[model samples]
Target: MQAAPPADRRRRRADLLTHIVLILGVLLFALPVWIVLMGSTHDGAAIGRGEVPLLPGAQGLDAYRRAWTEGAVGTTRVPVALMLWNSFVMAMLIALGKIAISLTSAYAVVFFRFPGRMLAFWAIFITLMLPVEVRIFPTFKVVSDLGMVNTYAGLIIPLIASATATLLFRQFFLTIPDEFVEAAKMDGAGPLRFFRDIVLPLSRTNMAALFVILFVYGWNQYLWPLLVTTSADVETIVIGIVKMIGTESNIDWSVVMATTVLALLPPIAVVVLMQRWFVQGLTDTEK
Candidate 1:
């Protein structure tokens, strides 16, 4: 048999060390989620009393059912299912809205050379420095003036104009070869037609990646929803989950954990489902 090379041995050692470190990291992150999952399966009294079981308990199904059908104790009266639906709708609207607006804005900036183009780009980009928190009062006044309070439009529209998304799309557009645009022009394609036929198709992966990110961001919004939605009908899961935690004496730990698990599932699923496209998009856009 041939002797193993020193380089091969060193490479193997490095691979083994990398695997060990990654495994440790995974366990570290997963530990809290595991505890939460286990806690959700147990009785509220057990969890509240600090008797956290390592294994799944007999109350798993019951806890999930209660959390789904009825809101957590001390939380909003809205059911978990309803809150989940509302969260889904809000997330989708925000993601789609951001992508639509960003794509068009970025395309115009990249393809058109109209007057004040750079000025417009800079104006939009400057918003990135000022987060929603800074302009909350003014934004709220605008929403209130528009009669959008407690409505889906109120929740989504204000948050949809994302400077980061616009920037990402702009960067990606700058990288597209001019040949494609020239070819489209040669084929008698108008701006809108070229955008629909060529640009959008090229942007598919980026859109998927952005969708995953924006969906999670929207789903996790707490302050904005709380500010805009006075009605329980439009309350998101994040807000609903917080409302679940009552005073120390009244808190139902098991139910709260269950609701947390419910809240986490959708974003997790979205990321998992779009993992391929998301990774590809990130890598491609960087070039």
Candidate 2:
């Protein structure tokens, strides 16, 4: 056992300092989440009164119950529960649909080389730079043309072609040992079979990570859903929240805080549960 040289010792100290800085950065990023949790547990009055509570007291649950039942402009006066269901259903469908479509497109681009492969890849990749706001009006018209207005198709179909997911999977698939694809092909595994038996299982971590990312996207979608859905009949949780802040005077802070808390649960649970997969996906993709 020998002590490090002076130079190496200083290097180690530098690394330690880097780690300390990184930890502090992480805590700073997490502060807003902590605030949301705290705010969710308090009533509108307490929150408005600046009574900052650190923990979830019994009163917090009571406020949550009230928010869940009659949080302003929720469908059926049970905005929290109603919006939760809407958000869950929409998020799930959009996430699943985007994954399925992205996976298939990525597989095609990765495994099967075509004449215009690079062109197609570049075309889809180009959309990544174009913000949704740029083409939303045309997209709305397209959906309207297909007569999918106010329907699930209008909400989910426009989002099915996630360029980011396609790129992520394509990059991941390229890293897979080519021998696996070769072996599947030798065993008469067609494209579909190859995808089913080889690509998907190996790509589960990436898919899970992508799922969380896209689920959050769908869950927090406001503009598209608002434009497409006419009323509470098919409105999402976010839409309900906006609706709560009516044009008239006097917004109910209590109901708003309560609804906000309730709305936060699904995405928070999603991030917590799939966190390992997300980490693995990022690591694997980085490698």
Candidate 3:
């Protein structure tokens, strides 16, 4: 057989190098998750003794079962199931609420011709600089004054208005053609009908992308949830995981590992399920 040309040989070497780098990157990120998975199957004492489990243990899934039903024995006894539910509710509510508010707000800002329209848009844009951290005290005061503390309303409502989402939706809206607006008006479709019929269908992909991002944001929120919630009934999975990792003596490593695994499932499921829409929305070449 004839030997491969120099260019072909070089291309093969480059492909090999690229794959090696990709594999190494995967291992770098996945190592901790593998250790946690193996650790969760082992006895808590072994982990506490600094024994990093690299293989499966005889404990099987008991740790997970205990974690799911019993919860973090070190910090509190609220069930992992309840915490997961609370987190799901908070994330879903926040994601949906932000999308709804951002969609309408952006629609009005882009489509309407009110006085100070640009001024209103600038005002909303300016709020992006004032994140929840900066306004935590005043926001908490408002929630507290309204008797929303330790309630779902307290956890979800305060986090629902996202300037980032509004900005993204506004940018997307501006790309829509003026002809579509005029066509809808000529057809006697009111603003709401035009929005419902024309805009929403065109925005499905973007909404899916934003939903994934906002869901993860709400799911991973630590400080805000930590501050606003004092009741176990409204405790999120992230907070529960932190609570599980208390003073070393109180730490049940197996339970913590198991809880961590459980906490990761929902967000992973969402991403995996909506991956196509998420990728398309972010990297759309057509529009």
Candidate 4:
């Protein structure tokens, strides 16, 4: 048996310090989740009275039940449930559609030898510099002309083409060896076959990461849905919350917090469930 060298001992000390810092950082991030979960359960009177419940309080379910029913039953308007469905539907469409468009566009640009390829990509890329707000009026006209206003089509169609997703897939595709594409072609595989059989399977990690990112973005979309949907009939959860805040009557902080927590569940679930793929994708890129 031998004792470690002084230099090795110092390295161990540094590693211990690093672990401590990382643990503290994680706790810092987790604190808000803790507060929200606790606060959502407390009644408005209790919460306002500063009687914070560190755990599930006796009245927790009561508050949650009220929030879900919007403080009444058989009202024909469960805004919480309706908004949840709306957000999920819109987010899923945006995620799937964006991935489809990105894969197709990236495959063409990276693997094919086509004329005006750069020009075509550049034209799309240029739009990335401009935020959606800049083009909203024109987009509104298109949606309105198609009679898609206050409809799911209006909510999802305009978000189908994601420049960020395309760029991410393009960069990932570049890292892939060219030999795969050449071999696929040699096997009499056409462009579509090559992409489907070869490229997509290998690009799963990137696609998963991109899907999660796009899903989060779509879930948090407030502006586009707000402007497009004129009535509560079509309002997404984000818009619903904003409307809740602007109600002319007294504000119910407890109900508001409860709704906010419910709204956060989907995005939180998305990140947690896709965490493995997200980490794997980053690791692959590093390699």
**Can you list the residue pairs that collide in candidate 4?**
none
Q: List the residue pairs that clash in candidate 1.
A: none
- Backbone clashes in model 2, listed as residue pairs: none
- Residues 1-287, candidate 2, lDDT per residue (tens digit)? 99889999999999999999999999998776666567666665566576766676455566567767666643345457867887788899999999998898888898887899979988999999999999999999999999999887788888878888889888888888878877987899888888888788888888888899999999999999988988555778888878776536455555666677678888989999999998888777443
- Give the TM-scores of the predictions, in the order they appear: 0.94, 0.82, 0.97, 0.87
Best by lDDT: 3
- Pitting candidate 1 against candidate 3, the one with the higher lDDT is 3
Residue 110 Cα positional deviation in candidate 1, in Å, after optimal superposition: 1.0
Looking at model 2, report the run of 10 residues with the lowest lDDT sum.
70-79
Worst 10 residues of 4 by lDDT: 70-79
The whole-model lDDT of each prediction reads 0.90, 0.80, 0.92, 0.81
- TM-score leader: 3
Clashes of 3: 0
Clashes of 2: 0
What's the residue-level lDDT of 254 in candidate 3?
92
- For model 2, the stretches where C-alpha displacement exceeds 4 angstroms are 1-59, 73-78, 246-248, 285-287
TM-score of 4: 0.87
Each model's backbone clash number = 0, 0, 0, 0
lDDT tens readout by residue for model 3, 95-129: 99999999999999999999998898899899987
- The model with the greater TM-score, 3 or 4, is 3
Q: Candidate 4's C-alpha lDDT? A: 0.81
